[model samples]
Target: MTGSGTRRLGLSRVGAALARGWRAVSWYVKELVGENDYERYVTHLRRHHPETRPMSRREFERAKLDRMDTDPQARCC
Candidate 1:
């Protein structure tokens, strides 16, 4: 292969690796911050409680905060 061709291939590999790394970091951050909790809750409802309706994001967050307020020990800090 030509020198420029090999360089292009190496650059492409680096770009792909960087993309995968970014996705991993994004997913980790979202999970750590409970950003995906509503999505997970919806999935759980569809699978295990098909008869129940899932809460809207606003309602879910409000309820979650209310629970935490009632049980201060559940707070991390």
Candidate 2:
């Protein structure tokens, strides 16, 4: 291949790598922010306890808050 073609190929590979890295970072950020928790919880409930109903988002958040309030170890300044 010519010099320009080699440079283009290198740039294409770099762009793909950057895109993959961005996607990974975005997923991590979503998980870190608890954005995926509700979906995961729902999936878990459906898989493990299908007979029981899953909590609504509001109920889930309220229950989580209540638990945090009751647990001293869960507090952070």
Candidate 3:
């Protein structure tokens, strides 16, 4: 219990540190990219992570159903 509490405290400390770092980075990014171009960042990600098979609504539904069938225990009562 003591170890778990210590680990939780350590994680919180790390999160705080990361939040501070991210704030600094975000401010720098805002200055570098400007407010207007901030939305273009998503296009950059999409360029890197191009889709293979474009999913239709039906395909998505079928895939979800198949997954639920495969894992009976995952289904809620």
Candidate 4:
């Protein structure tokens, strides 16, 4: 209702919007860099192959690299 109160409310709203935008950008960057791939793979294994043991980070990265080496489609132009 007061001038200072209104200014504070506007600032809070702007802060919240900035925070959400920052989070979106962060997620995009993570995906772009393959940072979330391991987490996704682990989730998939848990969902579809619960009996199988999930690969460790090193093993998973090695396996991914091997597959890319063997698969031509994985190579960039």
Clashes in each model (backbone N, CA, C under 3 Å)? 0, 0, 0, 0
In the order shown, the candidates' Cα RMSDs to the true structure are 1.0, 2.2, 16.1, 1.4
Compute the lDDT for candidate 1: 0.94
Give candidate 2's whole-model lDDT: 0.91
Model 2, range 1-77, lDDT digits (tens) per residue?
Answer: 89999999999999999999999999999987777888999999999999999999999888878988899687563
* Candidate 2 weakest ten by summed lDDT: 68-77
Candidate 4 has a TM-score of 0.85
Best model per TM-score:
1
Off by over 4 Å in 4: none
Q: Which stretches of candidate 3 lie over 4 Å from their true place?
A: 36-77
Evaluated at residue 51, the lDDT of candidate 4 is 100
Pull out the clashing pairs in model 3.
none
lDDT for residue 76 in candidate 4, whole number 0-100: 73
Per-residue lDDT tens digits of candidate 3, residues 1-77?
59899999999999999999999998888866444233454465467766654455466557667978999886675
Comparing 2 and 4 by lDDT, which wins?
Answer: 4
Clashing pairs in 4: none
Decoy 2 TM-score against native? 0.70
lDDT of 3 at 24: 92
In order of TM-score, best first, we have: 1, 4, 2, 3
TM-score of each: 0.91, 0.70, 0.40, 0.85
